[model samples]
Target: MPYRHAWLFIVTLICATIFAFWRTYFSILPEAAIGFHIHGLTASLWLLLLLAQSWTPHHGRIGMHRALGRVTFVAVPLFAAGSMAVIHSMAGGTVGGDPFYALWGARLGFIDTLALGALLYAAGMALRHRRNVRLHAGYMLSTALPLISPVFGRVFNRTIPGLIIHGPQDFPVFGLGAQCGNVLAAMIALWLWRRDPRFGRPWAVALGVIAAQIVGFETLAHSAGWNALFLTVGTQPLPVLMAFGALAGVVAVWLGWRLPEARGRPKQDA
Candidate 1:
């Protein structure tokens, strides 16, 4: 039981997600885009899955934990598809030169890409090291990091006064809200790594990824080349992009499961 209170963390994240998207998605669910519906449903299920996975093993229900773990084979692909659908939708928004999209949409799209990459990386590592309890749990728990920013960033934007100051063209001058959320995520990862440095490689990796994400948000998001690349990606068919994302998930799961366990690590029950 590496993360003894993991269920608590997952539950809190679920609550934060609901609060963050209440006005935009939950309150107007029927009117939301198909992509949003897909993303929301899959993402919520993923969190609930994480909750069950955490609770079962900690409660000495290893059988149930293994059963639930199989769900990720299907869940990961669907989650990835949903994520790509939302990314496509966001990219499409940058088409008509809306000031918000022109300035912020590309940045958001870039960040989304990084977040998705981080998710896949964490998931893959978790599956690959499934036999080593410490590594497996650490990697599995790290999956939650990619999700923190999107949830809390919205919360900050809406709750904190002047967090997202507007400038000319109604563009956001300071994206303090999202930055704060990312900083919080990084802090959590760093704290986790500090708790058990000997068995904290996964968290360490997560911390590096988050740091890269923050740096990319500030630098790569503003790059002319990245903006152009995102705009090009936006022009492609949504279905194609989603299909590619789903394929990546499938490949990650297959490869991770098939890979040999690390040397010198004894197999441990979930």
Candidate 2:
């Protein structure tokens, strides 16, 4: 079942991410070092990596899947760095938007960084127990769940005529979209979990992470305190945040590789 359907999820992620940013990233006159290129390139690369990861294992290329997993150890950090760079560029006025908008964007940036870190770390840990393939796949696929918020936001703003988004007050639109994406991911996880008993714990973890992110982003994206926090952290460079996120990814990979293998009968879908 996984080999049959894994490509569908990968394709969905690629389409969603690329279509959401096609105009901004593929402009006729692209600016040099404006950070979008970095962000877009890294993001696109990761999606491609995801596609490769999904494809290799399904096609009986376990060796290639392991090699690609190693690539993600590096790719994850670069992706976090790109997220920071883009947000920092925006917060620094390099993109030249309203100051308030920049601050809000910065806050969103921080959220994205944290979400990416959590997803990678959780997925890495899941990978550790090769005895539990269902959990491993659940975490791996669920990593993309948190990223759909921005995708939906961009797609909505561009496609919906005259969608006036006023600062953080109107953040509910994007917030709800993100939550919907999480719900969809949860539904998929639930289906997989029902198919295999081993999927329970991993699905629960993914759902917990998604629900936490939804609560956090929705609650704080509009709060005065959140605004103040970003304003205070303004222009200080969030390289530390990026570094922390990267460190989480590295630790996840290390734990995955170093943990003792589980010895048990392999569980399979009924």
Which structure among the candidates has the greatest TM-score? Answer: 1
lDDT of each: 0.82, 0.63
lDDT of 1 by residue, 178-243 (tens): 778889999999999999897788899889988988899989889889988888877888788889
lDDT of model 1 at residue 111?
A: 74
TM values, all candidates? 0.93, 0.77
- Model 1: weakest 10-residue lDDT segment is 165-174
lDDT of 2 by residue, 61-133 (tens): 9899879877877877677666666665555552355544453564475467566766666667656755466
Return the lDDT, model 1, position 256: 82
The runs of at least 3 residues in candidate 1 whose Cα sits more than 4 Å from the true structure, single-residue gaps closed, are 164-174
